[model samples]
Target: MRLIRISTNYPAYIQNFYGQRSALATQPYAQQYQTLMADCYSWADFWTQAFGKLGYEVWEPVGNAEPMQKMWAQENGVSYEPKTWLTDIVAAQVKQFQPDLVLVNDYATYSRSFFTHLRQICPSIRLVIGWCGAPYSGYENVFKAYDLVLSNIPSFVTDFRTQGHKCEHMHHAFNPAILKRIKQEQNTPIDFSFVGSIYRAHNFHNQREKLIKQLVAATDLRIWANMMQLSAAELKLLPLKQQVYDLVQLLKRLPLGQTVLPYLPKLKSYARMTNRPGLEQYVDPTIVARAAPAVFGLAMYQTLADSKMALNNHIDISKSYASNMRLYEATGVGTCLLTDGQDNLADIFEPDREVVTYTSAAEAIEKVNYLLDHEPERQQIAIAGQQRTLNCHTFDHRARYLDQLIKKNLA
Candidate 1:
């Protein structure tokens, strides 16, 4: 039993975090890392902490945090160089800890060679678990290396299984400590609020963007997100992008295509984008301009906590499943959530009792107005949702399930 969990934070949060704590950068690597994880930024140290609590010896390293890794290398006497994170840094950590299990939250970034190096350096390693929530087209062979694959989306589970890999479905959970960290007043200020992304005009986010636009036009909704606008030229070529993506995927499945197809750039990126210079035609750029900048970490929790009702919409790729962090995050922080309706929603929440759901934007608008006008019912649902999340949907529960899953396989 020892385990190592690999996770990273958003580049925006990393930059902001270090900016706010300039002195922290000068501290020892251990001290800098301790301060960094104290904010509980993203899922950075969550799995390690959760598994450690259950008496499993676990270590979590922020995988993509290069500055921190460099510090670790300096402190541990591990040599560092450019583009050697896989060869030098991570391999050294594996060789030192000799963990039995390695869980990669951002699995697509690394290749099979990285895992091979780990296996070579640490023969004690038993499982290579990967967490993939989005559709990654270019990382086909990268995924084939995982010992077990996990996704919150049921469809993704099916996709992994169809690709002839071992996969399981799990729901993302909330950290209740967020409540203690971010205090909320009794009287909430905002009537309705939304905190999410609207990156591109096509794919799952396109549906979310469309719904957000309709809701914003119809209701008094305040929004926050980090969005990038696509150029007019890119917008015009979206259809062509879709065609290219389809053709690539189709060819990848063919017997002949398996031999000679090289991965091309922008193959299916237009399908789901959060960065700049992509699909922006989905939503009116004016709304993006008017939107408050995206919130993260504790600020995001405080934002949701202060809102009377927070809206959540799943991406189109979710495909009839309620699979996203917002469900637990919004509800865990004590806000009435009005998310898009999905089949497994009731499995997680009692709908109307714990959370409210809507099938269409028009319906969401109608519910938003009614919830705004009626205070007692909305607060009641919010309270219940928070209770459900605190009681059942937490990293502790997830850790226990993971413990069992890993043990069964080990047995």
Candidate 2:
């Protein structure tokens, strides 16, 4: 088996700044602190190299002009022209890699054009696959373009199949390396910790401040905004492009007090910004970049090693879907996670068994109290969740399953 996988946006470093158009842009404050980067790209690098072990060749488009960076930069006033467009470059990469299968992440707004160009170049490639999430609406058209579509949101798989498209449910997975990090750091203690975007929709910034004000008033609460790091002047004069070179320094966190004030006058507008509107052109690049795709890396480890219990509150937004890498990440790290229950969570673990759940602020506070009071039970739940992740949800498992799915679908 052979494959070419594509992702539109990923972090620059494990613990780097959020550049203007990147994830850092949305939550400028995250750049001020230490935020661990997710290792999805590392997963890509690992699995690609590991494919050789399975007697398959893999090629991924790497470097800056890689589709993700190029597309993101332009949208955020970072880069005007991407080094290469999807169709042309991918077609060339396919010819060079000579793979039997093609795997594409559902990042691009329009995937058909890319798939069509690829099929034109390599009609005998055997299979073309695209993994997707919600928004199965107009996707019936795109679904027909590929030989198969992998849906992480399994509930919608049957709907696509009904449209004469071959769709399958493939659950999300973690990387063992991250779990190892969790184990290594499980003993280290942190005060109060949270990892994710600070946008209004995801509510990373506001919720964090609220938590800090309440339970963590005296504790050391660290938020790794993971957005681009920038100076004071840059934050004030961003997107306007007043001084070209000076803005290049990059910035993340704005003073919490000052940042929220700007939003107070225009809470409605600011809230909408966090909600994520428009397409590649108008949408804030940082929202996509800084949110941390594999945000679970250090958070999981940190939650277990440093804190008594880690808080996982997803922003309530219309379009937002619970990424749940945090849920898996926290569990894998053996960190006691207290998250607002989301869709299909019970399928992953029993609410009070593998992980704990809460709906209201009072309940969340109560759960934290209960877990802290009962240390052994908390540890038991943590151990159970970690074992489950280690057994079934590592990135290695994801890659292996992906390989088999492609072969089976093609056959």
Candidate 3:
């Protein structure tokens, strides 16, 4: 299968092993990370190389210095700059690397035009794939140019398909190397840990906000957040512009234990976040890897080993889907999974059996407290969940699912 992947970066360790391995099926996994545009490792680089090694012809377009140049300008907070030069340069590269499919990761301002230009040049391409990690906007017509759109959310696929385009549900993968690295470096016993941010406070409910606050208050547990929230006094204590940056710095220093919630803003959420500064800078992988690693959550299988209890909550969106990446990760690690109870959650895993679910903030707290006190029951749930992940949810299984989907669509 000859495919072309156009992502921001394709480095294996960073992009969840999309482009590093020389597998049986991979040949030319041509990919590139826009280094001038962003300072982080790119997932595109990893996948492209992986496919290339597997016997696919890999073609990466690098003639576009304009995209990287524009990305560099954006890094310093200059949004008014024109990227015509960058787009022209990238267009030349696109012409050279033309292939059957174009795999897109986050479709931000930096790479949107790149996809549009590719479609203009090659309409007969069998597929153009866009990965959606969230249920937000800017996807209205951006995906219209593509053959398929993929996301973990089934509701998202339903909405797109209803609008008259083909789409599919593809779960995200954990990088085996990163997991292996974390496992090797930390011998610390697993304990309860939560990763991700409590900022974007407006996007969450009062109850959800309360739950986060309560976790912050608990001393027995190691509470972590992307950054510490400003107390009423702290907010009042700083200068306006400086306050935001200070908050960002504070969040960087605070031990989040583990990272969760990959935030790629769709159009509306992007606009809603006007007042929030310093968010764009956090996209770098090195910055992400720095938060206190003693306890982390989010990865489906490897994260469970970071802590005994992993907090799993649904991001407020159009649907309340309970079965998330963390659900599997926590279970797979044999870490006691305490997740928010959502519709259809029980269908995915037996409540209080393979995994445990809670409907309210109080319920979540109570469950965590109970699980901490009852070690034997906690271990039982952990073991069951771990066994389930190992048996059913490995990347190898998911890869086959992708292969099937591709064949069905092509046929």
Model number with the top lDDT: 1
Q: Report the C-alpha lDDT of model 3 over 156-227, residue by residue, as the tens digit.
A: 778889988788877544333334433521443546766544334333333444565565455244434344
What is each predicted model's overall lDDT from 0 to 1? Answer: 0.82, 0.55, 0.53
lDDT per residue (tens digit) for residues 99-140 in model 1: 999988776666888888789888999999999887677787
lDDT of 2 by residue, 262-344 (tens): 44553333333432222222213433332333243343355444655666765433113344456666666666667767676
Superposition TM-score, candidate 1 onto the true structure: 0.86
Weakest 10 consecutive residues of candidate 3 by summed lDDT: 24-33
Best by TM-score: 1
Where model 2 places Cα greater than 4 Å from the true spot, the runs are: 11-43, 49-55, 63-87, 134-142, 158-164, 179-183, 198-222, 226-308, 313-323
> Could you tell me the C-alpha RMSD of candidate 1 in Å?
6.8
Clashes of each: 1, 28, 42
Error of 3 at 350 (Å): 3.3
Better candidate number, 2 or 3, judged by lDDT: 2
Q: Against the true structure, what is each candidate's TM-score?
A: 0.86, 0.63, 0.63
- What ranking of all candidate models by lDDT puts the best one first? 1, 2, 3
| Model 3 residue-pair collision total | 42
Q: By summed lDDT, which 10 consecutive residues of candidate 1 come out lowest?
A: 270-279
